[model samples]
Target chain A: MEKQVILDPQQFDLTVTRLCHELLEQHADFSNSVLIGLQPRGIHLVSRMLDKLQEILPTPPICGNLDITFHRDDFRRREIPLIPSVTNIDFSIENKKVILVDDVLYTGRTIRSGLDALLTFGRPIQVQLLVLIDRRFKRDLPIQADYIGKSVDTLNHERVKVSWKNIDGEDRVELYIKQTHE
Target chain B: MSSLSVDHLLGIRNLSVDDIERIFQTAQSFKEVINRPIKKVPSLRDITLANVFFENSTRTRLSFELAAKRLSADVINFTASNSSVKKGETLIDTVNNIIAMKVDMVVLRHASPGAASFLSKHTKAKIINAGDGTHEHPTQALLDAFSLREKLGELNGKRIAIIGDILHSRVALSNIYCLQKLGAEVLVCGPSSLIPKGIDSLGVKVSHDLTETLLWCDAANFLRIQLERQDSPFFPSLRDYALQFGLTSEIMESLNKSIIVMHPGPINRGVEISSSVADSSDSIILDQVENGVAIRMAVIYLLAAQIER
Candidate 1:
């Protein structure tokens, strides 16, 4: 097994700043748009994005936290049980632009579940995906992110993990490679 | 699903504390699933369930049916009146016929005690006991605990007084089994004759005095007194029973502490609980009914996880 550090603490901060700026470029006033962070892992990423968005705009629109555990495709196929997080979308998503935020985009199955779960609140005029890490050439679905912080090419046996400062004690991106033959 | 001890949910007696926690945790997820706009999930897709009710019921049967349907499982319902049970067919024979049709699970409500467990041994399909005759209603107790946890946060060290006819109550037996497992102190309060013999041996306090029990408890579950089940008089008369045990607003105010009020269903109104006390904010009878679906769904999902085919 091997490990690769794609982004250090300084690089991760820059990526967060750039992604927040990219978000503000499309949604300037945020009048008809709202931010939603996918549940469990995405909640931390969304709060970080919100902290960055607050620097640009004094008052940001309400943010939603969505749980896609029940809507996932491999619910029965998986060996481990799925525990669902809370879906805290107080405001309606009707006819509003929604940006779904997550930490990583790999097989795109999570994003697909998020998309299915998002419609349960209300029909959105437009929907976009924002991820901190984009694992290239390994999508089980045809979905693509509208906003991405960094894209990395990895093998099928490789795993991309985004660590947060609060949870994991530091901010960084690392890839774990399995050494089956070596 | 990782540590689920039993393949079938026959009673709370066989369930470990971890199994109860797992069921409650899974029910919490299913509760969230029902709040969605689509109101349906495909988790139980390709699974089939049959609801076999050999006894009369309203809430438990419908709750199990709705829970199965919400999980996207194909459901077929059978009642004693409409089925061959009326023609003297045995329980195993009737259930085996349904299992032969490739049904995955069975939610059964029978007047005979241990009917689900008996069927579980004879048939390959998983069995869930909605309610057995004076035995244990596992799902009912789970939902009651779920509702109590919602109101009181957790069951640990909480005092719960289950008041009414314990002799005939499947609910009391099951609730005692579950609440004790969840670390709640249980008190069985009822008329001396109405309280079952040896109920005190199950690690719960038994008392006929209502005020003393109410003062010592945080929640009170007033079980319906089945007049039909009492062939010989347990109490002197209805008026005597009501005067002694009926929960009134005056009794509620005398407690001087906030307490949760719960009842199974089909309330006798002025008999067991007065209208004022039953309609008060403390009464979570409706929440108990709603959580029934989620609890049943959790039981089915966890049990089905162990099914090989």
Candidate 2:
């Protein structure tokens, strides 16, 4: 029943600037690297990062969006009519260093699905995961993010919500207790 | 409608309009999956599907088998041509034996009607009726309707004339139910004898004139004359039938406006529809075949997902 703000708009902007500098330090040219945003939610983060990466570098890299809806492990656990989002990766991801961007890292199942979904485009030379809010030690799969904005330890019942300025009129991260039927 | 209550896709009638939409919505996902470079997913890796076909088929069996494989399920193909069914085993025993092997689902095509509906009562595995005797080809109807919606958006109030052997078509029967459910005006056009009695009672208009019907429709789905399934003469001859009802270029061109052409193939090219019209731009006949895999995948994925609940 309680909610707490973790990162406000100013802190989030500074975090993005640091991440951009770290990314520029490693992959200076941004030629062989490509960024992919996991669909339905990661799209917002991908757009922000792509914009930020362009500002931080001379050349912005190729970016695409992927939907891992069909690749999910729990399709059978849910009801019928699981609506699929659009996957709009026009160019090939072949042999590129792929960076998967997402809003949160929870069970790592979404990242697993995203990895599987990425294989469809072509086998990438290397794949890395990036999350704005990494919920540490909460993985059902053995996936760990290579680049994390902030690592926060939390209870299984708590939810991490990432909001964007374009979407929720503010850039912020919050923690809340996920409500379930009693 | 929330989830498919029936456990098996025995017929389109078993699904509500909402269920059909859900299936299409799910199919949209699989359609995207196949377009990917790997074209496979591990969602059904733990699930095994036994395609127990009791009749000769090419497209339907291949499509379902591909669908299962694409979903990363183990596929065990049991055709009547090479099965114990040829050695005097009953349908129930053969399928139950497969299910006993821990097969999670069965995609069936039987010569007898209600084979899937019958088998679902005995087996713990989920069932998907690929096709049954003049009964229903649920996936075909689903793909056909899906292809239609994909080609021309919003099926509500769209006119679709299903032209050809209605009396012998499981496709026609299923399409009528499916199309009508989506709020499309359906017209069944064929030879008088080929038209089943009291078909209009299903709330579809009946027409013997193909041109008249084609002109009235935004989409015309041509059913191949089911020569293989015919026991006795329903019409006088193929030539006479083609003369009266064949969809030629002239007939098609006369309509002035483009109508979406569809066929549940193995098309009798010059009989029901001319070769020209079959290969026409507006024809989504091949798209239906490609969409068949995605539709079957959606059907299996949804059915297998709901076995426990």
Candidate 3:
């Protein structure tokens, strides 16, 4: 099985830096903005982006980690699922602009559920979606990322894995395509 | 359209007053079931309930496990130390694996708020949150409410003081919701730091003085201080905490004669509450523990019956 490398560690960092600058330029007032990272890989990416954003912006946005594992749409069928990280939003999101961060965007089911879970905490002024990699697939919901790092066209059988130095000991994106048996 | 299936018993905050009252009424039926000679029922026959405990919780976990078994359900015990959860399996993945075995329910306990709520969304099996961090213990609240109902016959206009580590105690939060919904005047008394901010917004009064709260309430629900607090900055010193907020025998004597004492044990004998008060005639601590089984049985039975019907 041949593994294709998409984004190297340095390349991923540059893309995140560019995204942070773009976010600051558009928003103008970054004080009220908050970055919410989806559990597992998204959380690591968000932390890295937050570090970059802190250096660029006047007042760094409030960043929190969220785990939507329990909020998934297809819960009944799956075996014992891994308990995701804690959902820690100390400050209220009532009127603040929230940018949800995720590692890879696949079916967009996670993002949909992430939005649903966000609503339970409080109503936000606006919610912008950000993904490290956007593998354009048939999305069941009308949801799109506000900022996307890399767009890769792939078959339904392909799987993308995002590994970070902070979490997975290595930083790279790998694509695993299912093989056909003759 | 029917309501969203309450797949998990997270807390009373989301539940309407009617829904809470209905659960209490159902619990009353199970209370009768508990009084029987067999003290067991076949309501949950052949059902499997997994007790996934990620934290050290003995009473709540045991009561829940017993409740499920009393209903004739098979109980599987999994602790954080022994389970594959220690080997990097995510909480959801572990739960998903268990659910694949066709388990009917998951009674979870984690040392983080909203843990059970998070689990409920990931699994199709009904979730009974045994205790989730300092957020809520719905069944404990249900049983506390049931015990109160059994004692007073009515909760409306009754004054109840919840003393001790309110910030870290999910029991206090659940009791506040249950007591307030049942028309009881809830007062939370503890150290300034241990008292969570905005708790007054829950329609309960907050006080730092324990004696004042004791005099004003008909019942005092004392919460146990987690041993882990010894290292935390929540309190200045254990001796100071005991002097300021602890429920001593002398303090219990000063309270109104009709006032009852309640504690969600395992009691810290000399701390938070003294031995005399814990063993006092007015103390309902044992009753709370016993009622825990019946109340949990009621919750499982009610939730399961809802699915069947």
* Number of the top-ranking candidate, with lDDT as the measure: 1
Give stretches of model 2 more than 4 Å off.
Answer: A54-60, A73-83, A137-142, A177-182
Is candidate 2 or 3 superior in DockQ? 2
* Model 1 segments more than 4 A misplaced: B1-3
Q: Give per-residue CA lDDT, model 3, range B190-215, as digits (tens).
A: 98888888988888898999888988
How good is the docking of model 1, as DockQ?
A: 0.51
DockQ of 3: 0.01
Error of 1 at A79 (Å): 1.0
Which tens-of-lDDT digit does each residue in B113-151 have in candidate 1? 988889889998989998889999999999999999999
Compared with the true structure, what per-residue lDDT tens digits does model 2 show for residues B124-191?
A: 88888888899999899999999999987989999999999999889999999999899899999998
Give residue B229's error in model 3 in angstroms.
5.2
- Candidate 2: interface RMSD equals 3.0
Candidates ranked, most accurate by lDDT first: 1, 2, 3
Tens-digit per-residue lDDT, A23-100, candidate 1: 889999788899999988888988998888887796876798998877787765667545567888878899999999
- Compute the lDDT of residue A169 as modeled in candidate 1: 100
Enumerate residue pairs that collide in model 1: none
Q: lDDT score, residue B83, model 2?
A: 69
Q: What is candidate 2's lDDT per residue for A4-28, written digit by digit as tens?
A: 8889889998887776676777667
Question: Is model 1 an incorrect, acceptable, medium or high docking prediction?
Answer: medium
